[model samples]
Target: MPEHAEAGPSRTRPRAPRRKVYPTETFIDGRGDTLAIRTFAEEDTDLAGITRLCDEELSEPYNVYTFRYFLEDWPHLTFFVFPSADDPEPIATIICKLDMHRERTMRGYIGMLSVDKAWRRRSIARKLVELAMSRMELAGANEIVLETEFDNGPSLALYEAMGFVREKRVHRFYSNGKDAFRLIRPLAQHPLLSMAALRERQDAEQRSMAKEGGDNRSAVPPEIAVLLAGPLAPPTAAHADAMAELASLTIEPLPKPRPPPSYIM
Candidate 1:
């Protein structure tokens, strides 16, 4: 997601016209499961859930938040929540802020990305980041930047895999003196980033069709064409079956060489 620079204690500037925002909603997963992704509206219930998730799963000491902080500032920030399919409660959250310092450059600041302990490694965080990037792009952001603890290997790797690069490292950047690394990526630099995003959505749709035990390759949406052109891991049973059906439709396939590894981040 985009990163926002820390605003100084200067006089408040005039606010820009607010864009039309839709209601928070869920995205259907590969198993016909619903994953809620919504804007942060200051409400008691949403605040409570966000607080619990951050306290429990994102216990980093450098974190900052307060009740008044949310009430007073959260409206200007972009927030999204991912609710668990089984429990019907929030499992993860991502916060983004728009940086107005640069023209036509929306700095995508990522803060408070946390997933429930029980929901780790299921691509929940990845999905959240993907959603954030999409939203930022839709908002006219040409690039995204974020910082993470230097020692956070999993996050570093995930961001790298998704096309971010280590732009700089600051010593003792956090209040507790932990070093931090700033990662940045241009949204248009890597074609694969968009492809991966499309694939994820396609995978979700394919899973929905498979749940009904019906073959529906014809239902493949045109918007998800990029995903159909590549191989994806954690494939649903229906995705595999659909691939098989597609394979039978073609003949005399040519041999191809393995592609090189990507090291964008």
Candidate 2:
């Protein structure tokens, strides 16, 4: 493998086998239609539909090893969605895994999330992440993280809106030489949303309260105020948004100061 192509996690197989106890879940789409969300079963091994969705919606390629690595380690975290109970192919899918990331922190990583292009803008990806996060939190995750192509606006916006913060940029992170952003969010250790997000929410709520009636500002939650006071920037890694563009401006140096004119010739 090329340099950094096979990271520590990618080279090592998961310590345990994958397991799932959840049943098919009913999800409501933006169209007010019902959708089925379920885990990948052993017999449901045909992943062509999944690979197609990933290929169409994502910029990178996922081979059989990548798919098996995630599914075999945490089948419950691998989810596929159908338009309905009888739908033949999955319209969306998400793969997730849990592990001790540094310092013994139980971290939950969202490996992949893809939604059919036809199903774009329906908040399907957001719903898929929510489902996975809920399970991860229940499983005792201290934090959650994922990476997205630097230019993937929709994906970045979705994760950021859900309280994930851009930690840093991985240069040449993609096979095509494009960069990527590693986004993260704290789970059990802190609130689900970022402090900035909570502050925004509080501001909105305060405005609404004022609009309804004045003098109830005390209704604001205390923890929210504390979080609002915290540093505005989400710490850990540089924000993903910062990597959107590189500083390309070229500044020319000013001319060197001329010494007192020594008698012009």
Candidate 3:
């Protein structure tokens, strides 16, 4: 049998096409300069500008690696708003990333957003956020989430106007010791509202009630304890129900008991 010819090097597989950037229409700032709003593009070198704007405006400090972590992985989700065609730096920018949250839901997280002071009140921030949300929704994100300073009225109002709700408050979330509000905008039925999440919430509430009961027992005064155990006290089942409600703090018991005297008057 003839010897087989030496095999040639294997051809490399073609890479998948890059995801398309989100589209935008023409927008002019208050100064009549046409603004460009779009995702980070291959030809763009705005990383330094983006970093500068964020550092100048945002309360949080991020190193270059943090910016790279998001931009390199999710360039399509990173958007910028330039005040004019000739301007090399963007006046506003929003950075975001999409991934599985809790291994259950597809969540989009907006990591940073900043707008130059000169560009304030021109609707630039809102427009950039809306653009990011639309792209995230199209990319199969079930919900988009972001955190802003709790007392940042302008940020809160802008997000709320766009249908985002305050999901929860994170205590001392910033390096400056300020609190933040985790806001969420659901493109579809949010995972937090699913049966599994609802069950988890219910169990948490029950545990909280149980803990409250233990606290109340320790806090009860001797005089009030006597009233709860007297002959006219509620029946056993009714008493349990009352205790449960009390533990939940749903209602206050009537006729507040006077404090027990330290000694006989």
* Highest-scoring model, lDDT: 3
Instruction: Rank the candidate models, highest TM-score first.
Output: 2, 3, 1
Candidate 3 TM-score over all chains jointly: 0.61
Off by over 4 Å in 2: 1-23, 43-46, 190-265
TM-scores of the candidates in the order shown: 0.53, 0.62, 0.61
Expressed as tens digits, the lDDT of each residue in 1-265 for candidate 1 is: 2387786687988899664344666676544667766666655546666777877875353223443333344343445546532332577777664443333344555655788887677777888888788876665556787778899999999999998999999777665678889888787733456666667767777788789787755365532452355565456665666677767864442233132112112
Model 1: CA > 4 A from native: 1-24, 28-33, 59-88, 102-104, 189-265
lDDT per residue for candidate 2 within 6-60, as digits (tens), equals 5555666668955433357797888787888888876355477678888888778
Per-candidate count of clashing residue pairs (backbone under 3 Å): 5, 3, 0
lDDT of 3 by residue, 80-99 (tens): 88755555677889998887
**C-alpha lDDT score of every prediction, in listed order:** 0.63, 0.73, 0.73
Residue pairs whose backbone atoms clash in candidate 2: 166-240, 167-237, 167-238
Error of 3 at 27 (Å): 1.9
Query: Which 10 residues in a row give candidate 2 its minimum summed lDDT?
Result: 256-265
